[model samples]
Target chain A: EAGVAQSPRYKIIEKRQSVAFWCNPISGHATLYWYQQILGQGPKLLIQFQNNGVVDDSQLPKDRFSAERLKGVDSTLKIQPAKLEDSAVYLCASSLGTGNGYTFGSGTRLTVV
Target chain B: AQSVTQPDIHITVSEGASLELRCNYSYGATPYLFWYVQSPGQGLQLLLKYFSGDTLVQGIKGFEAEFKRSQSSFNLRKPSVHWSDAAEYFCAVGEGGNTPLVFGKGTRLSVIA
Candidate 1:
């Protein structure tokens, strides 16, 4: 099966700039997630969606980050006025059912200078 | 709250030797546990997961994980180490079904020939 798809693979932006990352989850999967992975650390959840509805987003930097899964399919994560600490890999994952193992995309590496 | 911990920041092992990566989770109840591997410039891949059944669960790429409820641990192990097995390993826990996972800081493995 085709895996979750992510775009850009890499990005570089100055502080206070804006950036967006796109993701397409595996077909038939309804649960989608966005995570940020900093250097020397593990990926941290930014948001989660169950069929276009957000299930959780407690860790998201609401003032600078936003995400959407408009059609319950493709999703996008946007960061406005990026901070230097925002530099990290953005990972996208999808699960067929609740609590199932996720299939992930290659991820987009963002560097905020 | 659900949390995961990886005690080792990094480890080096010789080829053909045994390998082990420790993981411990804290949760109020029995949680779904998983092990994932991340290669440089790539995304996370499922190594194994334990939701129920036998404590020892095998995964792809010659990896396995054991869930110990008594210790609140789900450690990954490989009987024989390989150069290609060197990568960042993460342990995660979730409530299952529309819940997001809590991940550890990760442990980097280096396999020496």
Candidate 2:
């Protein structure tokens, strides 16, 4: 099967600017997730969507980060007033359900200057 | 708080030699464990997962992991190494409910001949 798809493999933005990342999960998957992976660190979940309804967003920085999954298939992650620290890889993943495993996208690498 | 630990930040082994990557997770109840591999500029790919049934589980690319409840460990092992196997390996954990996976700071492997 075709893997999860992401757009703009790399991005560069100035501090305080806005940026967006897009993700398309595998067909028929019911769960979508957004994660942030900083350099030298592991990926951290920012938000999770179960068929368009948010399941979790406890770790997301609400002031700057927001995510949405439309029709429970494609998702987008946005960061407004991006901070220099926001430079990292934003990854998207999906799964069939709670018990199933996840497949990740190549990620959008953001370089905040 | 729940967390995952990768003891080795980097590992180097010669080609055709045995390989091991240690992963330790902290959680209250029975956990969902996973191992993911990330190539340069690529997204994460599932290596194996431990949900139940078997303690020792095999995955793609000749990789296997043993989940030990008592030790809180799910260490990845490979009988022999290949240069193509050099990549960053991550350990992740997820609890029941809609909680997203918590990842460990990956272990970067380097294979030499």
Candidate 3:
């Protein structure tokens, strides 16, 4: 099966600039998630979508980070006025359902200068 | 809230040697556990998962993990380490369906020739 797909393998932006990352989940996956992995840290859940509706965004920095999974297929994560601390690898993952393991994309490495 | 702990920040072992990476999770109920591997500039790949039924789960690349409810631990193991296995390993715990996972800080493995 085709793996999850992500675009713009790398991105560099100045602080306070805006950037967006795109992801395409595996076919037939009903759940999608966005995670932020800072250097020397674990991946933190940014947002989660069950189909097109959001299931969780409790950890997302709503003031700066936002994500949407439209049509319950592809997802986009955007960071407005990106901060230096927001510089990290953004990973996208999908799964068929609960108890099923996830398939992750290569991720978008964003560098905020 | 649930959490995961990977106590080892880094570990080094010679090739063809036995390897073990420890993972501990905190959750209220029977937790879904998973181990993932991430190479440089790459996304995470599922090495194995333990949902139920079996305490010992086998994963890809000759990796295996044992889930111990009494210890609240799920540790990954490999009988013989290879250079290719040198990468970051992460342990994650999640609630089934529509819920996102909580990941550990991760353990970095280095294989010496």
The most accurate candidate by DockQ is 3
- Superior candidate under DockQ, 2 versus 3: 3
Candidate 3 residue A35 C-alpha distance from true site, Å: 0.3
Report the lDDT of model 2 for residue A28: 86
Please write out the lDDT profile of model 1 over residues A65-98, one tens digit for every residue: 9999999999999999899999999999999764
Candidates 1 onward: DockQ, in order: 0.82, 0.72, 0.86
lDDT of 1 at B67: 90
Per prediction, fnat is 0.81, 0.67, 0.86
RMSD of 1: 0.9
What class would a CAPRI assessor give candidate 2's docking? Answer: medium
Clashes in model 3: which pairs?
Answer: A98-B97
Off by over 4 Å in 1: none
Candidate 3 chain A least-lDDT 10 residues:
A95-104
Ranking the candidates on lDDT from highest down gives 3, 1, 2
Where does model 2 exceed 4 Å of error? Answer: B96-98
Candidate 3 residue lDDT tens string, A54-84 = 9889999999988888899999999998999
Q: What share of the true interface contacts does candidate 3 keep?
A: 0.86
- Error (Å) of candidate 1 at residue A65 is 0.8
